[model samples]
Target: MKAPFFLFSIVLLSILSSCGSNKELQERAPAQFNEVYYSQTENGLNLYIPVAVIQENRVKLESVYFRGMHSALNLDAEKPNLYVASFATGKGDKIMHEDPKEEYGNKAPQAPKESPFKIESDEAILVFKQNEKTKYYKLTGIEERN
Candidate 1:
């Protein structure tokens, strides 16, 4: 019937659209990321990436996905060709204000399942825009500095 055909078409479209093209995302980024590093400060973890944009088109660095968290990158005012992202590493003390009845109705939430494309601990996925298209570049073997 027409209804069944329509449902099948929708399902097919969904699957196709969900698939991303990673041909441009090489194993390593094209830019010069030789000094990409991170440091753990009292406030949080500060990531520093010194990039040399070589593409003809201007590359807009979007965000960094690291350690299961996504953070927006910002250009440092004092440094050129450098992008930085910060992650809060400290957790504040919990306040003693809660209601057992309102807390999930006495049922604890289920544990979160692992994502299919979970990022590695020592690697980061940089989401950027070039030529008006969004792209991802993986930077591996990141080192930590004191």
Candidate 2:
């Protein structure tokens, strides 16, 4: 009888300790961004913009899509700190790559022909607005995935 009681008390203590540890872990986790804008093109391109990026004004886009291809106009910002542009089609979403010479020939790099959104920073605030209402998100540092 004594041995059985001792084992039951140990199990209860272990369960309580695990529950406390889980709560602590959740509190330490980073906060997630809540704002997001979902825009799609007539062809198939889809763009998802975070409100933090707009508040930070890191993006400057003229149109969402042009000739069935997603445009990366805001990517032309000069001396941008950390600008990330992502787009998706039927395949999947992908981060836009900035390759000056690869995409363009010897001629000077020109902005995309069409754009719908623009991102610019004024006093560390993102200046982005659209005709339609969109959700807002919290700004957080970029995380690299392995």
Candidate 3:
């Protein structure tokens, strides 16, 4: 009787512990890294991204897509089906590194630039970032697979 009860208690404890083990917050890598998606419809576009590339004190998500030119055109919920696109971005999350300055500490980095208007797809993650002298980011195009 004692042996049976001990075994049952151990099993139950193990089960309970495993349930909430992952519930606690933990530093997790970008869940959307290297992920991409695409869509092209009537007067519409879509691009799913889940990556990060910090440059010039800006996060400039590698996985998130931005719209418009240098003008910070805030995309609305209707802008792109973020829900269907996979991972999305928020204003506060422009970059995802601890220090913005450290990201571009490599050398006399060129100025920021923008990608020309010529995205030939619905779902796309194309961006252009410019800086002081030359074009820092010419065209960071991101294409989704399947």
Candidate 4:
């Protein structure tokens, strides 16, 4: 009985110590993108990307739109064409119309009418064609303002 109890105590202690180490690792981990973009539109599409995600070549967009429309958009690292994706409106997230998935059915989803740009760096860039000329808008991290 004493031997079993001693072994159980040792295992429990090891498990507890490992758990504490994991928490410390998470807390000390460096952020991928120090700053995030805040949506000025009604959809409230704010995206946060960590440095690790970018390094891993996997981009994840987090957003919070109204009742309708999709708030999240992901660009897989394996697919390069997806990087130069389009959007519904030239304006901000608020102007976006209904989600293509709901309208055309998930089977035949429509591409966004407007192609934003191919995200390849820390900054998010939006390219627009104005008066037969191309314009660029570089999105900076919101935290940088502070």
Model 3: residues >4 Å from true position, as ranges?
Answer: 1-32, 52-58, 61-146
TM-score of 2: 0.21
Worst 10 residues of 1 by lDDT: 107-116
Candidate 1 C-alpha lDDT tens digits along 7-70: 9999998888777533355464646665788988655677888876656366678887777666
- TM-score per model over all chains: 0.66, 0.21, 0.24, 0.28
Q: Using lDDT, give the best candidate's number.
A: 1
Q: Which ten residues in a row have the lowest lDDT in candidate 2?
A: 23-32
- Model 1 alpha-carbon miss at residue 19, Å: 6.0
Sorted on TM-score, best first, the list reads 1, 4, 3, 2
Count residue pairs with overlapping backbones in model 1: 0
Error of 3 at 47 (Å): 1.7
Residue 124 of model 2, lDDT score = 13
Query: lDDT by residue for model 2 over 41-139, one digit each (tens)?
Result: 432332333323333343232333322234442442453432334443434333344864554323222243322223221101122223332212222
In TM-score terms, candidate 1 sits at 0.66
Whole-model lDDT values for every prediction: 0.71, 0.34, 0.37, 0.36
RMSD of 1: 7.3
